[model samples]
Every structure is written in structure tokens, then in C-alpha cells.
Target chain A: MRIEIPGEEYMVSGHLACPGCGAALSMRFALKALGGKIIVVLPACCWSIIAGPFPYSSLKVPIVHVAFETGGATGAGVKAALEMQGDTETTVVVWAGDGGTFDIGLQSLSGAAERNDDFIYVCYDNEAYMNTGMQRSSATPYLSWTTTTPANQPKENPKKDIMEIMAAHRIPYAATATIAYPEDFIRKLQQANSTRGFKFIHVLSPCPPGWRIDPELSIKISRLAVQSKIFPLYEVEGGEKYTMNFEPKGILVDEYIRLQGRFSHLSEGEIELIQENVDKEWNRLRKKAGG
Target chain B: MKKVLTGNQAVAHGVLLSRAEVISAYPITPQTTIVENLAELCADGILEAKFLRVESEHSALASIIGASMVGARTFTATSSQGLALMHEMLHWAAGSRLPIVMANVNRALGAPWNIWNDQTDSLSQRDTGWIQLYCENNQEVLDTVIQAYMIAEEVYIPVMVVLDAFFLSHTSEPVEIPEGGEVDKFLPKYHARYKCDVNDPHSFNLMVSPEYYQEFRYKIQYAMEEAKKVAKRVDDLFAKSFGRGYGPIEGHLCDDAEVILVTTGTVTSTSRGTIARMRERGVKVGLLKIKMFRPFPREEVKEALRGAQKVAVIDRNISFGCGGIFGHEIKATLCDEEKRPQVFDFVTGLGGRDVTPSLITEIIEYTCQNERPEGEIIWAGMRG
Candidate 1:
């Protein structure tokens, strides 16, 4: 298939992001899709380091490194201000980490979405707070190991249902994407770009250090997540309409869990329990998508 | 045309005349009226702007940031807790240098949940890289909003026009709303030199390593210092166009006064009134009204109080362990001077408590009679 992607490139090659950083790749693809006419609102996150320093930015587009939880609010303001100047063509994207999106930034994001603020809010979900050294976040999955949630007693709470929370706002568009699936991710971006009102794209990013996975297996793990129905690829329009983008192969959830060191300590029973949970979630999502 | 309007309405009219393209705000007491009026204007097509009704203060700031990124002239308003909620984005707006204008109705920060006048909320955000302007009355509120955009865009920094809650925000006074065409002539449409343009896309507000972060901070600081001159120039031009003038600090009867009262926001109005009353009673007292709080007119403040015998600072806000919020700032500004006035700090009118003229007279009288006390914060008007 000959796919004609975006002609302009906003991100440069010499970035300081860690190799196999899913968030960085997400930004790279986002810049490609949004083209040069973009303003990236970045809160405090790993991308902050990835964008390099002032006078030497990694992305070609203008970046606004804001506070940890101001991504959504700041983006809405920028968009409004741009429209005032009779320049509505430029796209304003709030690129935030899972911590910023799910926890500290939840209120702002909720406000923006509720108001139907015209902008793209992209949450690069690495599952934990990597910038501050692998601390626990609301996005952190259940039974995950981090500096805060040690191996002995992993994360007690389940990962927040961010997609559902965003979808609840009845936003114009809300979707889940991954770096492993570039074409699907890019396609979703195009769809969001075309739609008006609030658009949310939650990308499940794999962390090399935080996830304790082989640096090269980031894409493989991300793919496995979709295949095993652990992190299903789906979209919701107007909060009610749900559509599953790709059908899972119905593989055992262990296929996705065993590779990551953070989840290595899970026993057979625990794995079975996780598999049951995945199946139940898949059923619920399929039902929502009308099978 | 001159119209009798509350300080909130005057600010709203200033925003309307400024031709602001977008407004994103969440309702907070005192500041709610400003946005409510703006929303009404947008609805009535009097002000052609997009009014974004956000769910929270954070979203209000974020939405405006996005709007500003696209190069729109944006505005928003908040007070106390709402301002605190926008604390994180305040840093972002400044760091991004979006030149977004905000109206802050000064209120006390809560533990006891007070909604009265104080400078703690805005003053706490002193380091957020925004040009903070404190207005004493409705006229200043109206004029400052128009000039804030000019000064902010000139220096490429966000500006916050602060007014005391109830005193200025809810109080009514006559204000001259400048003609839109005249305002346009004075303050042209904001053309960001470094905005997010599709034609020339360049990364802004990116993360920087330690190697270059200092440079970014220095640039912000340099821009702020430059803003002081830009603020002066804009105020000068505004005066020339509107037939009125203002500065970082306004001195009232301070030339030959033995006691000077340093204050900000609407309290300055009461202080002026008290100065007149005291002057009638043979008291050599004057008033120093501080307009700009961020690029804190330190040199100007020192020069203004140079010949004064004693400087009594009456702050409407408390700094917890410290005496008065503004008092601490004033003392800090004059700390290294060769000869400083005997500074007395008095905390009063917290949580919207009244700052009547009689209280001001009594404070001045006490400061002139008693010796300066160390770390003493006399609670003005607190009856046992």
C-alpha cells in the first residue's frame, strides 16, 4: 500500500530521548502528521528532556514547555489567541505524559474537553512517572513495579480508565493508539485533525527503564498488548459511539506480560487472573462497539 | 465616554475595547463578574470573541494558552484559589511568552476560606515570569488592561492586572472607556515575533538541559527588566492618547511628609483619603501607591521614600509567619539602602475585612508615635 504521509517534518533526528522511548516516537509521528504549522504545549515530562534545550530544539515546530498540569489549559488558550489574530490554520497540540494527563492534569483536561475546546490532547502513557525516576502514577497498571511500588508489593490499584474518562466528556473524538502501529496511529491523527471540538489520542507508550523491558522489545511489547487484548485499539465518538480499530488475536495475556521485568514476578494464578480480566474487558469493549 | 461602572465592569469594558479575540475563564468570586460580563458581550456580539466556558481554572488557562499559541489575543480572569489553580500554567504562559492578558482580583488564600481583598495570591506568583500590575481604582483597572497588552506583547511576557477584591472589583466608579479605534491606534493587533506558525514551524517551549536552562531563565529575566522600560513607554503613549498618565509607583503628598504609607491595589484609594484627612489634622503623612509588583519598582520605591522619616506599610494580606505581605516586600526592597525609613508592618482587612479611612489614620498615627518593632505585625482593627 502506497501511503502518502505528511510532506513536512517537524521533529529532527538529534534528540536526547532514550532509545526505544515510545513517547519520543509518538512525538515524531505526531509532528509528521501535524506538519510544520503546529505549537506543542509540553508540561513537565520525559518529552521535556527529549525536546532538547532552548536554542537547540529537536522539533521544527514551536514548543511551549509549560508546567506539569497546564498542558490542556495552556493549549486551549493558545488556540484561542491564535484565532484572535485571524490565524486559525495552525494546530495546537498538548503533548503531556501519563502523570500530567491522568493525575495532576486531569481537572484541566476534563475542563478543556467539557468545554469542547478545539485542540488535540495527546497523552503519551508510559505507565509511570519516568522523569522523576519511575514513581507511581494514576496511569500505572495494577501489579506494576516502580521505584515507589517496589517488587514485593507492586501497584495496588488498577490503572485509571483514561479513555473512558475522556470519552465521558462526550468529546468529538477519543481514541487509543500505539507507536508499534504507525499507520493506524497516523490514520487516527488525521481523523482527529479533521474533526472539530475536543480530540483526545491516548498512546500506550513503552518505557525501557520504567517497564524493565529490553530496549528493542518496546514495539514488540506494545504490539503484544493489542494482540492479547490488554490494551485494545479502539475509538469513541461523542462519548457513546465505540469502534474497535483492530481485532485482537485472542492470545493469552501472558504473551504480553512475561517479557517485561516489572511483571516477571506474576505467578501462574496471577497471569490467569489477568487473562480473565482481559477477556472480560474485551467482551465489554466489543459489546460497546456492537460486536 | 465616561460611565459609572464597577471596577469589574470597567475591566470588562477595557477587555471589550482592547478587541480581545478569545476569553477562557472559570468562575471565581470577584473575578466571576468580569468573565460573566465578557460572556454577555460575546453573546451580544458587542465583543467579537470566542468565549470558552471551562470547567476549572486549570482548563481556563490551558485553553487560553492554546489560543495564544495560534497567535490570538486572549484574556482571562481569576481570584485567590482560582489564581492558585492556575499557578502551574502561569509559569507556562510566561515561559512560552504568549503575551496573554489576565485580570486578577486579589483575594486571601484559604485555610479558613476567606474571599476578601489581599495581595498574597498574586504576590505568591511573583516568580512566574508574568508582568504583575496592581490597579488602585476603576480608571487604573480600565487603563491598565489596555496597556497590559501593549507592555506584555512588547516584552513578550504575559501580564496580570490585579485589583483588590470588593474594594475595586465590586466598588463602582466613573471610568472612561476608550474608543476601539483609538485603542487600536494606540495598541495594535498582537503580532507575535515567535509564534507557532505553520509556514515557519519552529519548536518553542522545549525542555532544556542544565547546560542551556540558565540561558532561558536569563532571557526571561532580561525580557522582564526590559518590560519595565516598555511598560513606561506604553504608559507614556497611553497617557498621550487618553489624556491621563500613570507609572510603576504613584506618589501622593510625599514631598515634605515625615511619614509615608506604602500600599497597593484599592487600599491606595483609602490611603489617599486618609492622608487628606490626616493632613487636615496637621499630620505630615503621604501615600506611595505601588502599581507594578513583579519587576518590583525597587529603585523607584527607594527613591520615593528617600526623605521620609518613617514608612508604615498596611497590607491587606498576611504572609503567615511574616508581618504583612507587601510590608515584607517593601522592607526587602529597602534592606540594602544606605539610609532606610523606620518600617512598621501592619496586617489588616484580611478576608475582605473593611479598610476604612479611620483605620488608615490610626495606623499612620501609631507608626509616627511608636518606635519600630522587629518582626511586629500589628493586626489593624482586630477587636478583642
Candidate 2:
């Protein structure tokens, strides 16, 4: 397969992101797809640090760093203001962490989406709060070992069904993408950019330090997540119409889990429990997709 | 032609005349009527602007921020918890310097969830870098909204035009709704010097390290200081054309009074009424209305209070653990003065509790009779 690199590079090379950071790659691919006519609204997260310091920005596009819990609202505001100026050609994309999107920013995000605010909201899921040091977030998977949730007591809550919550808004577009699928990810971005009203793209980005995974295996782990049916790639149009983009091989969830240290402490029973949950979720998604 | 209009309707008319391209808002009590009127205007084609029906107050502010960054003259109105929800983006709007104007109908914050008049909501955001302008009446509310955009765009700072909750927001008074052309002459199109331009790309509100963070903050402070002059110029230009004027601080009988009451927003009107009644009875009292709260008008405040024997600050908002919101600011401004007036702090009218002219009279009479307490905040109207 011929892999085509993006012709335009909106993201600069000297970003302060960690080596092989999946969230950084997600940003690169997103900016590449959206092009220079983009305004990135970022909330407090790893990306906040990754964007580099002021007067020394890493992206060629304009970035508006908002508060941790205001990504959706800020993006909506930016988009509204832009349209007011008769500049509807530019795309407003909100890039937020799982903590920002799923937890603190959920109310605002839900509000914007429900209003069908003309903008793109991308929740880069790193699972935990990597910016303020890895604390447990709502997006943190059950049985995950975040600093706040030690092995003795892993995350008590299951990973929030963010895509479902977004879908509930009956938004024009909502999709799941991953760093390992650049083509698919870019395609979704282009689709979202063209669509009117609220469009959401949930990117399952891997965090090397927070996830306690080998930096080199970031992409590999992300791929395994889909292959294992742990994080399926799918899209919903107008919220109700669901379309699964990729079919997982239904590999053992342990294969995806073994790559990360955070899940290493899990016992066989716990791993099996997670596998059951993944399978159950995939089945439900398949049913929704009319497969 | 002067017409009696509610403060909310006056603000709506100001936004309409200012030619705001977008108005996004959620319905919060005391502030709901402003956005509701705006929505009606859009529906009636009285204003050619997008009236976004945002689901929450957070989204309302956010939508305006987005609109303003792309070079739109954007506006929104909210109060209380709504303002708190937009607390995070308040920094974003100012840091991005979008010059988005907001009308914050001041209300009490929640735990008990009471929705009434108080300065706590807006005053709590004093550090968010927004240029705050408090209005004393419907006329000021109407005029200040027009001037806020001018001052905000000039200094590249987001401006918050605050009105007393039920006092100004709901109360009806005669306000001159400036003509569109007149407003156009006074307020220029919002042409942002630095904005999110795609063709000529540049990063905005980017992360800053210690080396550049201080400079960024310093520049914001410099812009705020510059806003003081811009505010004065805008007010002057406004008066020249409309034949009325206001300042960062409005002095009422302060020229030769022995005691001056320092207040803000609609309370200033009641204070003036109280001062007038007192003067008839041979009490030498005056009023100092603080219109601008962010740049604080520290030098102007000190100069205004310099002649008074005692200055009693009446605050409607509490800092909780600290005393009154305005009292602290007043003391901070007078801290370095060698011969300062005896500063008496009085906290009253929180959560939209009424502060009639008689209340002001009592506070002043008490201050004159007793030794002015230093560093102590006296609750004037709280009943057990």
C-alpha cells in the first residue's frame, strides 16, 4: 500500500511533546488534514505543554489555549465569532484531553453539541490526566493503574462512552479515530470539516509515560486496541446512523493489554473481565451498525 | 428621543445599534431578558446578527469568544452561576484579547442557588484581565455598552459591562438609544490587529513558559493601563457627540464634603439620593461612584477621596473570609497614602437584598457618629 504523506505541514517540528507521543501525532495528522485555515482551541492538558511556550509556538495555525473545562464552549465561541466576520471558510477545531472532554468539559461540550454549534470537537483520549500528572479521569478504563488509582485499587469506573454521549446530541457527525490509522483519521477530519453543525472525533491516543508503554509501541498498541475490539473505529451521522469503519479480528484483549505496564498488574480474571466487556461493547456496536 | 426602557432592553438596543455580528447567550435570571430581547430583535430583523441559542452559559461565552477571534463584534449576557461557568474562558477571551463585549447582570453566586443582585459574580473575575465597566443606570448601561466595545477593541481586551441585578437590569428608566450611524461614528468596525488569520498564519493564546509568561502578563497589564486612557477618550468622544459624559469614577458632591460614600453600579444612584436628602438636613456627605473596576482607577480614587475626613465604602459583594470586595480594593488603593481618610467598610445588599436611600443614610450617619473602624468590615443590613 502506498502511504501518502500530507503535502502541507501546519505543525512545526520543534514541539515540546514527548518522544513518540500519540497525541502529538494525532495533532499532526489532524492539522495536516484541516490545513492552515484552522484555529485550534486547546484546553489544559498534555497538548497544552506539547504546543510549546508562547512566542515559540509549534503549530503554523492559530491556537487558542482555554481552560481545562471550557474546550467545547471556547471552540463554539471562536467559530461563532469567525462566522460573524464572514469568515466561514476557516475551521474551528477544539482539541482537548479526556479529562477535559469527558469529565470537566462534558457539560459545556454537551451544550455546544446539543445546540449544533458549527465547529469540530476532537477529544484526544490519553485515558488519564497526563498534564497535571496521571490522575484518574472519567475516560480512564476500568482496571487501569493511574497514579491516583493504584494497582490495589484500579479505576473503579468503566471508560465513559463518550462517542455515545456525543451521539446523543444528534450532532451532524461523530466518529472514532486512532493515531495508527492516519488515512482513516485524516478522512474523518476532511468529512467533519465539510459538514455543518457540531462534529466530534474521538481519537484514542496512546500515552507512553502515562500508559507505561514502550515509546516505540505507541502506534502498535493503538492498532492492537482496534484489533482486540477494545476501541472500535466507527462513525455516526446525525447521531443515530452508526457505521463501523473497521472490523476487528476479535483478538484476545490481553494482547492489547500486555503492551502497557498500567494493565500488567491485572490478574487473569480481571483481564478476562475486561475482555468480556470489550466483546460485549463490540457486539452492541455491531448491532447498532446493522451487522 | 428619550424613551423609558428596562436596563435589559437598553443593553439589547445598544448591541443592536452597535451592529454586533453575533450574540450568543443562555437564560440566567436577571440576564435572561437581555438575551431574550436580543433573540426577538434577530427574529424581527431589527438586528442582522446570529442569535445563538446556547444550551448553557458556558457555551454562550464560548460562542462569543469564537466569534470575536475571527474578527466579529460579538456579545453575550449572563449572571451568577452562568458567569462562574464562563470563568475559565474569561481568561481565554482576555488572553486571546478578542475584545468580545459581555453584559454581566451582577447576581449572587450559589450553594443555596439564590438568583438576585450582587457584585460577587463579576467582581470574582477581577483577575481574569477583562476591562470591567459598572453602570449606574439604564442610560449608563446603554452608553457604556457602546463605549465598552470601543475601549475593548482599542486596548485588545475583553470588556464586561456590569449592571446591578434587579436594580438596573429589570428597572425601567429613560435611555437614549443612540442612532446606528451615531454609534457607527463613535464605535468603529472591530478590525482586530492580531486575529486568527489563516492566509497569514500566526499562533494565538499559545502556551508560555516562565521566561515569556511574565512579559505576556505585563503586556496585558500595560494594555489595561492603556484602556484607562482609551476609556476616558471613548467617554469624552461619546459625550462630545451625545452631550453626556462619564468617567472611571463619577464624583457626586465630593468637592467639599467631609464624608464621602464609595460605591458602584446602581447603588451609586441610591447613594446620590441619600446624599441629597442628607445635604438638605445639614449633613456634609457626598458619593463616589466607581464605574471602572479592573484598572481600578487607583490614583483617581485616592485623589477623589483625598479631601474627605472619612470615606465609607459600601460593597454588595463579599470575598468570603476577607471583607467586602470593594472595601479591600479601596484600602489597597489608599494603603500608600500618607494622610488618608478614615476608611470604613460596610457590606450590604448581597444576593439582591434591597439597599434603599435610607440604608445609605444610616451607614453614613453611623460612620459620622462612631470612631471609624479600621480594617473591620461591618455588616450594615444583615438581619438574624
Candidate 3:
């Protein structure tokens, strides 16, 4: 399989990202796909630090680190300004974490999507608020143990289906990708860049410390998440057409969860419940994709 | 061309003449017509700008912050609760040094949800480092909105052009709409010193450690001080292009007055009428209208009030535990003066109640009869 990734390096080596950070890899692939003629609007997220501090930056492209909930609005603004300045070629992309995307930033994101504003919104989902420490966000999966949701009182609710939310807006493009699948991630970003209106790409990034996983296992865990059907890799066009990007390996949910310490306290019954939930969701997604 | 325009319509024309590249806003009372007019202007192909109709006030300000960073002349307007909602982004806009101009029509903050005129909304944003300009009429509203872009762009600070909700925003007056060519000559297209450029890629509003954060803040304050001079320069240049000028503070017969009345927004207009009537009756009263609030016009305020035996501050807004908002600022301004007037803080006409000429007469009479101010807040026209 000749999975060709761009050789051009837009991201530098001296970023402040943790070892094997999935978000860092996702940004690298995104920047590579989108190239240099782009400005990234970052809301409060792990990427805020990962993008490096003032007087220093990791990416070659310009970045504007805005307020937490302003990802969507800020992206739209950047696009509007670019259009006003007669520089419509420059793509405006918003890179945010799960907390900014699914929780705090959802309103702005929904707004931009509704307007079909010209920008690409990328949600680097590490599940919880990884920057402030492992706290539960709406994107946190069922029974996941965050710092707020301790082992005894784990997350009870299922993760919010953000893809559905994005699809509901009937935006021009919406997709799910992960760092493990570099080709798919880059392809979706390039496609999003080519399309005119508001585009959303949800990347299932893995947090090493927050997810209680070894630094080296981030990619492995991300791949397992796709194969185990816990996080499906797919795309939606104009909120209706759904396309499954990858064929899941049909790995068991326990195999995916066992490696992470966040799920260490889960009983067999809880694991079964999670498997059942994942199966149901996978079936629903397959149906949407017309099997 | 002399045309009768509401304060909101004046704002739309000012923005149009200034050639603002981007306008973003959320609908709130008294401020809605400003954006509605702009929307019509944009849709009719009269104004070459992007009108981003955002979902909330937070997004309205946030979008402009982004637009300003991208080197576009941006504007937004909101009132009361909307301004409160945009508090966080207001700091962001100023800290980033994006010269985004905003019109805040002063409406009362509410738990009972009353939407009428007051100074509390923009006053609450006083600490946010935005250069605030209060307008007394529709002409000043138009003029200030045009000058704000020049002042803000020059100092690299955001400016809030404030006006009374019903008094100025809704009230129509014959405003001299400056020719677009004249405005273009006064204020040129915004040339940002620093902006988001992919070719010369850099990061903005990034995480600054304690080592450099204070210096960044110092720069903002330093620019604020510079804004005072820039504001004056812009006003002079504006007067050159168009035949009108409004400095940070406008004094009416204050030099020889025994008692002075300090006011802001439309209250200044009402006070002007009151001053003329009192002067006719041989009562030595003056009017000092404070146009610029954020940079406070401290020195100008002190200089104007220095000769008066007593200065009565009629405030339409209170600061919760602290007396009147402007009253506290005036006292603080005069605190270090070697010889200052007996400053009386009078709170009146809160939540859209009229500040009539009779009310002004009672305030002045009370101040003249008393030797000293009894308390922090003397509620004027309180039904005992």
C-alpha cells in the first residue's frame, strides 16, 4: 500500500507537546495537507501549549490563539477578513480540543456551521480536558475514569455524537480521522480545504498522561479505537451522504480498553455494556453509510 | 449632506464612510438597528464589507477580534446584557491590541429585564483597556464612530463609541454626513503594523509566562496614554477634513463658574440646557461633558474642575457597592489635586427615568446651599 504523505515539513521539532501526543501528530498531518497558505485559529486546548509560546511557534503557518469558546466564530472572522482583504486563497482552520469543541466551543461551532462559513474546524479530541488535567468533558466515553470522574464514580453518560451534531448543521463537509490513519487524516483535511463552506474534521487524538497510557502506545491505542469500533472513521457530506473510510478489524472492546489505566476499574459486566454500546453505534453508522 | 439620522443610522454611515472591511454583530435592544442598517447597506452593494451575523455577543466581539488580527477594519455594537456577555472578548480585543471599534448603546442591566438608557453597561467595561468615547447627540455619534477607527488604529487599541440607548440611538437629529472622499482623506485604509500573515508566519495571543506578561500589559497601558494624544490628533485632523471638533472633554463656561456640573452621554445635552437657564438667572453654573471615559480624561477633568468652588457629578449609573460610576472616577481624579472643588456625587434617572431640566435645577440648588457633600451617593429626586 503506497500511502503517500507529504515530505514538506511545516511543523518544527521544538514544540512543547508530550511524547507521542496524537494532537501534535494530527496538526503535523493537517499542516502538511493544507500547506503554508493557511492561518490556524486555536481556542484553549492542549494545542495552545503544543503550538509553543509567544516569540516562538511550532508551525510555519500563522496562528491566532483565541478565547476558549471562540473557535468557530474566530475561524469565520479570519475567513471574512481574508475575503475582505481580497486574499481568498488563504484557508482559515480552527484547531481545538474536545473541551473546546464538544463542550464550551459547541455554540460558536454550531453558529459557523449554520452560516456555512468558509473555514475548516478541526477537533483534536483527546476525550477530556487534557490541558487542565484529566477532567470529564461531554466527549468523555461511558465509564471512563477522569480525575473528576474518579475510579469509583466513573463517567456514566455516553460520549456526545459530535459528528451527528456537525452533520445536523448541513455543512459542506464533516469527517472523522485519527493520527494512526495518516493518509485518511490528510485526505479529509485536503478535501475540507478544497470545499468552500464550513468543514469539520474530528480527529480522535490520544492523551498519554490524561488517558493513563504509555507515551509510545498513543498511535497503537488510536488504531485500536478505530478497529474496535469505539471511534469509527467516517465522513459526511452536506449532512446527508455518509461514507465509511476504514473497515474495522472487529477487535474486541476490552482489548482496546485494557491497555489504558483509565479503564482499569471496569468490571467484566461494564466491559460487556461498553461493547454492546459500541456495537450498536457501529451498526447505526454502517446503516447511515448504507453498509 | 445634512440629513436627519438616528444615532444608529449615523453609526452605519460612519462605518460606511470609514470603509470598514468587516462588520460583525449580534442583535440587542437599541443596537439592533445599527446592524440592521449595516446589513441593508451590505446587501444593497453600497458598503463593500462582510457582515457576519453571529449568534451571540461573545461571538460578535470574538469574530471582530479575529478580523482585526487579520488586518481588517472591524466594528460591532451591543447594549447592556450583550456588552456584559462580551466582557471576556473585550479584554482579548484590547490585549491583542486589535483596533476594533464597537458601539455600545447604554441600556440598563437587568434582573427584571428592563432595556432602557443608562451608563452602567459601558462603564462596567471601563477596566478592560478600551478607549471609550461618549456621544451627546447623533452628530457626535457619527463623528466619534469615524474618529474612533483613526484613534484606535493609530494607538493599536480598541475603542468603544458609547451613546444613550433611547436618547441618541433612537432619536433622530440632523447629522452632517461627511462626504466619503473627505472621510477617506482623514482616515485612510487601515495598515496594520502586525497581522496574521502566512508568508511571514507568527503567533498571537499565545501563552505568555510571567516573565513577559506584565510587559505586554504595560505596553497596553502605554498605548492608552498614547491614545490620549492620538485621539486629539485624530480630532484635529477630522476637524481639518470636516468642520467640527470634539476633544476628550468639552467644557461649557467652566472657567468663571462657581459650581460645575459634570455629565456624560445625553445627560450632557440636558445639562447644557440647564446651564444656560441657570446662567440667565445669575447662578454661576458650568457644564463639563466627559466624552472619553476609558482613558478617563483625568488631566482635562482636573484642569476643568480646578477653579470651581463646587463640582456636582450627576450620574445615571451606580457601581453596586461603590457610589456612582463617574462620581468615583471624578473624585479619584481630583484626589491628588492641591486645590480641588467640593465634589458632590449625585445619582439620578436610573433605568430610563428622565433627567429633566427641573431635576438639574434641584441638584444645583442643593449643591450651592450645602457647604460640603454629606455622603458618597446623594440620590437626587428621591421621593422621601
* Best candidate, lDDT: 3
lDDT of 3 by residue, A106-139 (tens): 9999999999999999999999999999999999
Cα lDDT tens digits, model 3, B1-384, are: 999999999999999999998999999998999999999999999999999999999999999899999999999999999999999999999999999999999999988788888888899899998999999999999999999999998899999999999899999999999888888888888899999998898999899999999999999999999999999998998887788999999999998999999999888888888889999999999999999998978999999998999999999999989999999999999999999789999999888989999999999999999999889899997767
For candidate 1, what is the TM-score?
A: 0.93
Ranking by lDDT: 3, 2, 1
Q: Report per-candidate DockQ.
A: 0.62, 0.64, 0.89
Residue-by-residue lDDT tens digits, candidate 2, B1-384: 789999999999889888899888989898989988999999998898877787787777777776776678889999989999888778878887778899999999888988889899999999999999999999999998989888888899999999988888888998877778888888877787877677876666666667778888899999999999999999999999898899999888998999999999888888877898899999989889999999889989999998888999999999989999898998899989998888899999988899988888889998898776745888888787
| Global lDDT scores for all candidate models | 0.86, 0.87, 0.93
Q: Model 2, which residues run further than 4 Å from truth? A: A1-5, B371-375, B382-384
* DockQ of structure 2: 0.64
Which CAPRI level is candidate 1?
medium
Docking class for model 2 is medium
Provide a comma-separated list of chain B TM-scores, one per candidate: 0.97, 0.97, 0.99
Better of 1 and 2 by lDDT: 2
* Single-chain TM-score of chain A, each candidate: 0.97, 0.98, 0.98
- Docking quality category of candidate 3 according to DockQ thresholds: high
Q: Which clashing pairs does model 3 show?
A: none
User: How much RMSD separates candidate 3 from the native structure?
Assistant: 1.0
Quote the positional error of residue A205 for candidate 3 in Å: 0.6
DockQ of 3: 0.89
